[model samples]
Target: MSVRLRQATLGDLPLICRLRVQRTAWLAARGSDQWTVAGKGRPIEIFAGEVGRALDAGETWVAEVDGEPAGTITVNRRSDPGLWSPWELAESVVVHFMIVDLRFAGREVGRHLLDHADRLAERADRAWVRLDAWTTNSDLHDYYRRAGFQLARIAGPGAHGPSRALFQRRVVPAHPARTAPSRYSLQGYSGGNSAM
Candidate 1:
């Protein structure tokens, strides 16, 4: 299957939220508390608020497979407070809120979304793509590792959230001869030729 990514809009809020709920339930079924609160899934309002900010900042993207929403990812320069040092944040793009639809599981949609993040980092002149995975999810950690991300560190006690398993992958040029600027044709936005 081919995966196409486009900038996420406010109209996609429901789809993103539904993806979160669906993934949460899937995780619960596997006995993982990654996105759960007291054995219950996180409130949709809180998740929506977090994603809303990313959407507003134009840092979120939705991946589609065969014209159907299959996954979502958010990549930005901002790191969650205390997750990374200022120097680390300055040189990297932070990935957040990545969720792949259960129906598309094992289809490599997550890999394509992450490849997009790597491209975004290269376009933005960043050195690395960094992310903090759910601390308790060893499977997720292994997933990132298999995706070429190295485990940086587990956040210390000072870190404030369950997403403390830090990981990063260095950005490398896919084609060294291609020096042209990257273009993104985002719907509901301008500057289609600019870097995303």
Candidate 2:
């Protein structure tokens, strides 16, 4: 099956909530009890709160595979209060939260969502795309690395009850439309820069 990414709408809130619940359960199963720390209540309530706000503000995306909601993401332009890095938060776009059903874990849906979000960020003239994952989940940290994000730094054990490490990938400025090619365009330059 193939997964596709699309802008999220208000109607998607319900499915997004369900996905968050599954994600919380899955995370807890892996010994990351952070989700349960907030109480045994449904984690979707909190996820829905964030997703709803993002959707209303027009900053959400969803990934679907064969007509099923496989994953969801909320990309915001604002930094969480007191949680912003002086360097990374200067950008216009940030990934606040993202999750995929365990059933769709290895299908590359998350990478597709990231690619879509990157395009959206570039279109908005954003300088970077950033996110935070639990520091204890090395496996998830490696997953983000594989998705082309470089580690930024660790933030405190916030209300989420887990130490989180921020990650970021810088977005280069997009070239403007031109009828004639510029002289500096495609000149002799090696691709060995560390920027990649």
lDDT of 1 by residue, 1-196 (tens): 8799999999999999898888887877888876777643346798899889888878899999999999999888776677899999778778888999989999999998898888887777778989988877888888999999999998898876678889999987676676786774212323210000
**Top-TM-score candidate index:** 1
What tens digits encode model 2's per-residue C-alpha lDDT throughout 124-192? 556677876666677777888988888877766453335356778876444545234322111111210
lDDT of model 2 at position 90: 52
lDDT of each: 0.80, 0.64
- Alpha carbon lDDT at 160, candidate 1: 66
